[model samples]
Target: MKYTNPVVKGFYPDPSVCSANGKYYMVCSSFQYFPGVPLFESPDLVNWTQIGYVLTRENQVMLDKINSSGGVFAPTIRYNGGRFYMVTTNDTTRQNFYVYTDDIYGEWSDPVYVDQGGIDPSLFFEDGKTYFMSNGLDDEGRSGVIQCEINIETGEKLSKSICIWQGSGGRYLESPHMYKINGSYYLMAAEGGTEYGHMITYARADSVWGEFVGYAGNPVLTNRNKAPYLIQGIGHGDLIRDKNGDWHILCLGFRQIHMWMPYHNLGREVFLIPVKFSADGWFTAGRDGTAEYEYEIKGDFEQKEKKLYTFKNTSWKIDWCHLRRPDFDNYEFYDDSIVLHGSGITLDDADSPAFIALRQRDFEFELSVRLSVDGGEAGVTCYMCEDEHYDIALRKSPEGTEAVLKLNIGGIKHIENTVELSSDSAVLIVRGDNFRYNFYAASQGSEIYLGSGNTKYLTSEVSGGFTGVMLGLYSIGRNSASFSDFSCNYK
Candidate 1:
């Protein structure tokens, strides 16, 4: 059957997967935003459901005022002996840690800090012993794909950290995973800085220790050289075999709005690439080892359609996200309405704001929300980070309530357009396409088109962050606001 690329969309990067009881569980890198790592479950290699995140407790993951792209990095999820383990790096504190859970539907345990200093840490369990791997410095002060035997229960190092492979000689040698295949240890990693030149390389050794030989056809997988391709930045993959013993790789890649433009605001997403292993005990991924828009898989998995979640029937916990540490005490969620209290902190500050957002899963969509504010301002926004966002806000001006279009680029604020509202309430509409997002306001039986902002200015290449655009409802100042009948949809 034909399946699409980017099995998971929108800012879910550093793809990692592990199987348990014939079910596949996956995780992706979530930087700075609260609820660190977004989690998913798949019956086959395709259709995935957002179950929950690995780091949800305040003590498990740290994200207190850390700037965008400063929190959790690459996360690796592995299941063994009826227990699930997730290891990752808290880039904000430069700390490496792991958390475990016995129940797939429950909260994870407190972090077990590893002594290693690195990013993109992964766990490999072998014959009652656990191994920890990451792309960082080793005991010899050598930096590469480092490994060490670790006591999983105590986070204690049972062996010296060893530098297994230095990559295929590319910049940013990160996101390493180790696997034992046919009595040989194989190490796979990503390089090329995760941009246009990103790729995946591998090496194998007889033992799990040093002197590993690089694969002759090194970059076993990459789309760096593929032109006119909709998807690029293909690398940082994890291998998993399904119930039928068919091998598959879950990797990270991005989609540009246009073939001519390299910029992408949807952020790095998860892509599924099928793996083929020969009798020679070697594996190749994707067709011709490059990513594409669609793929043929070995399973009879049917595609899961995305449901349109109108606010009247939205799943608040599963979809909405809050910035920094959540001030949940100041908000309430209901079936038909959301009551949010504004803080003195503006959206311009990295501090906590009264905001809850949904990941922008589609490049083109329509979002409309009816908002009523008592004193200050309340509306919607296309939020990238604190410094880069486009707002269509309804603020209480000296001349009564007014609709305003404010654009914040690189910490510089610009008020592009404003119009007085005949009433204190209005319906704010944000229509987004590949190029720009246009705003509209409707009140007192009439509608007015606000302004539009370029999408390129809010992308990672220009905004300097690890996140994509998040469409959210927010309130600033001490006004208590009520928002209802919110609807965001794509056909």
Candidate 2:
């Protein structure tokens, strides 16, 4: 059967996968989002479902005053001894920790901090012993892929961290995972940064530590020079063997918005690469180590895609999320609707505001929302961060509510367009394509066009963050508003 690449889409990067009880589970970097470390489940590698998040409670992770790209970095989800463990880095706190739960669907335990430094941490359990590895300096202050024995239950170091392999000559060597395949220890990692030159490399050794040699054809997988191809930055992958005994590498990759346009507002996504292991024990990924838009798997299972939501029910909150830790008392949910009490915060504030949004998954889609603001401003925004976002709001002007379009790029705010209204409520619409979005407002008898704004300006590349564009509902100032009829349709 044929399956799509990026089985998991939108800003979800640095994927790590493992199998338990015949089910495949995956996790990725969440970088400052309130519910940190998005988790997923799959029966086959190509099809995925968002099971939940690894960090829901504030105590499990830190995002207080954290920058857009500063919270949870790459996370690895592993299963051992009937317990599920997730190890990650809080880049903001600059700490590494692991959280575990015996019930996979239940809330995870509070973080068990590890003494190790650096990021992209992973845990490997073998023969009643657990080992931790991260891309940082060892106890001796030597930098490389460092490893140490640890007590899995307490996260206490049982041995001094030691430098392992330096990798096959690439900058920003990270995302290290160890495996014992065919009696040989294989260490895999990504290098060359997480941008255009990103690539995956591996080495093999008789044991977990030391004397690991690079594969003869180092950088076994990379799309760095595969320019004309839309898929780039294919690295930071995890390898897993399926029930059928087939090897597949689930990695992170991003597609340029257009054929030649070099901007991706959807963020780095997850892609599946087919793996082939040689009789001698070396494995190659992709088509000769290159990622593609699709791959033919060994099954005939039909793909069940995630549906575009109209958010007409109580479950809307499941897909909608707030910035930083949510201000629980700011809003209440009823079937198909929400009442948001305006806060002193605005989208311009670098802190959490009265906002709830969903990831902009597709490049071309239409988003519509109906809002009635009692005071201040309320509307939908294509948000990247505090200093970089595009907002279309209904404000209570002296002439009644006004439909206004705001463009904030790199901290410069501009009122691109506005149409004063004589009503208390209005329907705001946003039709977005890969590069820009067209805004419209409809009321009693008049239809107002609020002009268009470029989408590229809100990308991670231009915005200098670790997230993608988010379509959100926001109300600012000290008032309250009712928002309903939210819908998103993909083209």
Candidate 3:
């Protein structure tokens, strides 16, 4: 069967996968977003469904006042002894921890902090013992992929961390994962800073501990220089062998909005690439060591896509996510409407505001919402971060309620356009494409077209963040709003 590259879409980056109980479970980095570590389960590698989040409770992870792309780094999920373990880094606090759960659909345990200091933590269990590795300085102050033994029960260091292979001369050596394949320990990692130059590299040794030999064709997978291609930044992969004994790498990659534009606002997403091992035990990924837009894979199931999303069809817990630690009192959800109580918090603040959003899954889409504001401002926003966004909202003017289009880029906050509304209720629309997002407003008469915002300004290349665009409903100041008829349809 043929399937698309990003089996899992949107801002879910740095994918790590492990199989258990005849199913494949994958985890991704959530950054500063609340409910960190998005988790998914797949019967076939080509089709993925979000099961839940690893950090569902507020205490499981910290996002209080966390900046964009600062809270959670890469997360690795592994299943062992009928239990699932998720290890990740809280970059803002410089802490590495792991949480475990026996039930895949149940809550996870509190974090058990590891003494080791590094990001992109991974756990490899073998022979009733566990090994920990991350990209940071070892006990000897040598920096690279550091390895150590840890007590899985307590997360205590059982051995001093030692510097493993420093990678095949690529910058930002990270995402260290170990696998025992055919009696040889294979150490796989990513390099090139998780950007356009990102790539996957590997080494092999007789034992877990090094004197490992790098693959002659190091950087076994990369799309760095593959210009004019929609896919780029392919790296931070976790290898999983399926029931058919075929190897595949679930990695992170981004889709540029336009060919030769070099701008991506949909964030790093999960891509499944085929991996083939030579007789000598070294493996090559994708086609010619580069990920492609589509692949013909061995799967019995047909790939299906969900193009339309509405409040009634999407789950509040599964699909919608907040910016950070949100105040529960500010949100109320019903059958088809959401009531947001603003608490004088604005989007410009790093702290959580009255906002709930779904990741912008594709470039060509239309988002429409009907909202009525009692006070302050209520609207739909194309949010990239605190410093970058575009809003079309209903606010109370001195004369009456008005529909306003505000464009926020860095320090420049401009009210691009405003239309006087006869009432407090209005329908706001945002039609987005590869290059720009067009805004519109309507009450009784025809929809009034507002100004447009360049999508490039909200891209990671310009905004300097790790996240993508989020289509969200937001409220600012002390007010309340009823948002209904929310629908986002992708073309």
lDDT per residue (tens digit) for residues 1-491 in model 1? 78887888888889899988778899888887777788888888788988888888889988988888888999999998999999999999999999999998889999999999889999988889999988889999999988999999999999999888899999999999888877888888999988889998888888878578887886888989998777889999998887877888889999998888878998888898888888877788888888877888776667776747687655677667788897887798898899889989778888778998888887888999898898878789899989999999888988889999999999999999999998989999998889899999999879899999999888988997678888989998998999998888875
Give me candidate 1's TM-score against the actual structure. 0.98
| Model 1: lDDT to the true structure | 0.87
- Model 1 residue 422 distance off true place after TM-score fit, in angstroms: 1.1
How much does each candidate deviate from the true structure in C-alpha RMSD? 1.2, 1.3, 0.8
TM-score for all models, in order of appearance: 0.98, 0.98, 0.99
The number of the candidate with the highest lDDT is 3
lDDT (tens digit, per residue) of candidate 2 on 27-145: 98888677888788888888887877888899898787767788899999999989999999999898999999887777899999999998999999999999999999998988889
Q: Model 2: residues >4 Å from true position, as ranges? A: 313-317
Worst lDDT window (10 residues) for model 1? 305-314
- Candidate 1 collision pairs: none
Candidate 3: give its CA RMSD in angstroms: 0.8
The clash count of every prediction, one per candidate, is 0, 0, 0
- The per-model lDDT (C-alpha) reads 0.87, 0.87, 0.92
